[model samples]
Target: MTTSFPDPAAFVGKVAFISGAASGIGAATAGRLARLGARLVLADRDAERLAAFAAQLATQDVLALNVDVTSMASVEQAIAAGIAHFGGLDLAVNSAGIDLPRCATAHYPAEDWDKVIAVNLTGVFNAVRNQIPAMLARGGGSIVNVSSIMGFRAFAGQPAYTAAKHGVIGLTKAAALDHAAQGVRINAVAPGFIETPLLAHLSEEKKQEAAMLHPVARLGQPDEITSVILFLLSDAASFVTGACYEVDGGYLAR
Candidate 1:
């Protein structure tokens, strides 16, 4: 049998910027986008892991930058490096985020809340702040922000995570609207209970419980979310904007 699907590697001349590229969905998406022919600017605070991943990619032009997304100066420098390496950005994915361990609202430390907001919400803003101008310079581009299913549903003991994710949705929609006229398209992916390093800390019983929350009865893989992200960043989805594609295995439906 033969396949007629468009070759994923059609992005040969394009450039993409990805935050949180050190692990999980961010790493998976970076690999996927590279396989699809996009040159990459990979960013994360973990210098060791980031370099290791960059070295493994098939894309040789990969530029690895250690970025603390919470810091505006760090973000600006990363963007400068990206433009220097790839010329200009064609796509950007804001996947740098963190979640506090399950804790009751009353006991949720202000510090933890601040950390989550800084990395998950403000981090995304910092990505957009830097990449938008480069995309605009070239006429237009695409952006994918990683939100969470928790943004749309209530889960006990995750006040900070939920609030930060909700803010991501608002930001995605606002960016989509503001830049659509300028040929830029922005969207988000809201994933649920994926099997990633972030979730590896949970006990077997807790992991099973989390998996059962989704209608599919299994946790999602990072590739599952990456596939959708690649599509949104591709020309195939030029008409789609201000949308949040849920890769939650029907978790939101249950």
Candidate 2:
């Protein structure tokens, strides 16, 4: 259970349950945690991709579960699977979310708003509610929710997305307060524009425009967010809770 330089994050015997882990930030976080010696329980809706990812990391104590974060039943099933596979759950990353309907509040459709909220806000809630009990029973753990800069700031045409992200921060703080005393730390990461498969839907021009919006003059990578997440999940952040770490390349500053 030891590494060369004393991995403060020696999660070798620990279990990390991650939602939205089939790709993007979730996938990267899973890989990072695995490298740090954490047994992983990765959940996502994409069964095919999930299987492939699980296959690749199976040797590292990874179990893949197909889950729809919007569903309490699905979330619970995944949590149960994690406990069964890894014996108990020690940490969780609520990265399962969705984004669509890029329009102003006035033009945003009710259905689109509902869908976004269900997947982004409700999705995170389900993950947390399902995972916390196990973490509590184990005496201590960490929870990291993947929020976005829009959670605090605003873009021109993303009302539903912004609302859901803001809700995530509020939820994170409330949970942190509720569980910090129980040895469970809850926090959120608000990332700025990041280049991921999600951004692949945008045209070349749109992608560049989004990148330029960051003060860093470029978008973030999935790995960049992974670093912050790993730190928060590790013992290094034992004193940190209810905090919203901004991995936005100073986007909020501008």
User: Which candidate comes out best when scored by lDDT?
Assistant: 1
lDDT of 2 by residue, 203-236 (tens): 9899889888888889899999998898888777
- Provide the lDDT at 111 for model 2: 95
lDDT of 2 at 205: 92
Cα lDDT tens digits, model 1, 161-227, are 9999999999999989999999999999999999988897899999999999989999999999998
TM-score of each: 0.96, 0.95
What lDDT does the true structure give each of the candidates? 0.90, 0.88
* Candidate 2 wrong stretches, greater than 4 Å: 1-9
Off by over 4 Å in 1: 1-9
Residue 102 accuracy (lDDT) in model 2: 78
- Per-residue lDDT, model 2, residue 161, is 89
Query: What C-alpha lDDT does candidate 1 achieve relative to the native structure?
Result: 0.90
